[model samples]
Target: MSRKLAKEISWLLVTIALLTMFSPHTADALTITTTRKLVVLDPGHGGKDTGISSTTGILEKRIVLKLARMTSKLLSDQYRSLLTRTTDTDLSETDRATFANQNKADLFLSLHLHAGKNKGFFFYFDTPDNTPATNETTWKTQGLIHRDKNRQTAELFAKNSQTRNKKVKTHFAPAPVISLEGLQMTAILTEPFTITDIPGTAAEQDAFLAPYAKTLARCIETYFENKF
Candidate 1:
């Protein structure tokens, strides 16, 4: 009600307007529109912690990172795509989940590979913790609140992959103790992308991930269109 207070508030508003008009991050800020859902892709393992390997010396960490980037590129035009780790570096499971939550992600996905044969895609949805967190209000239980949506999203992708000639098996795989804990969005993790499935060679990775990501992008689009 005081004139001094009114003048200060008006000055603040004018300053904010000027900053909004001239800030370099204006475009970046605008990209965070509500109309487009945000998807966070997490490539599991990095640095010294190489997940798995094959006879050809293909590292699981390397391949999954590339796959995450490829998939993000495919999804970029339709939705906001981001990755937890952009390079070959070690990122903790907690940090990855925090990144997704901080970004207010609409969906979260983790990519990993295993040392095994090509047994289709191992898709995962979050499950309740074996020993559920005592504090229900904590972030650790966020996945439990969104568990149904997470499972449905996993199923949607799995069904779509089958149509694309990729065999996908859906399972309730993660607990709060694992990578997907405390995510406040629909989450899925694809596992054990074998060397046989996506070989060590760049040529093989590209060949496998291109079509794989294409189908994945389409599946994500479908999920957003129908569900969100």
Candidate 2:
């Protein structure tokens, strides 16, 4: 080949290689950072386990399930987020934690209702020591609870209590076995309302619970934006 022709062919090959290297296909394969956050909502007690029952016949499981659905809707509308359990089916505690971890959740909230001869909202968390007995005692005594690392975050929600008769308490419990093995932020179990067997508290419980759900949703949103 002529020297001039050889030079032109070599330049053409170099241009083609450069074009292939910078093509959209290559760019599409590059990893990109994600800013989206995910939260897992676990509505506790379902199926055969109806949870606590109120004098008015409202089941604890039902109330929490409804509240969870509402919270999921609010999160989706406000933050375009995700949820762990979106229905009234049974989910093992361990399974719930696994789902949250697998999804790379930023937060894991287990929603439940308090039951007894009393009424109020309560939040639960695992103790630093991971001892079940010690954790139960701590909760019974303080009513406001969590691991040392999560105390500040727990107090933020506890202080926002709006019930006239209900007081917010923080207490520690053994870390849920499911959360022990995974990457997750604080796993909070909230008793936003109560389903008491006590008389005359039924209507009161219903009245307090509906608004409580709304407030809790706001608190969660604020917590993530400001703290986590």
lDDT tens digits, residues 19-107, model 1? Answer: 98899687676766766788898999998989878767778888888888888888746588889999999888889999999999888
Query: In candidate 2, what are the lDDT values of residues 72-136, reduced to their tens digit?
Result: 66663435345555666776766776787677766667777766334344344553555533434
Tell me each candidate's TM-score: 0.79, 0.62
Reference-based lDDT, residue 141, model 2: 21
User: lDDT for model 2, on a 0 to 1 scale?
Assistant: 0.59
State the displacement of the C-alpha of residue 136, model 2, in Å, after optimal TM-score superposition.
Answer: 25
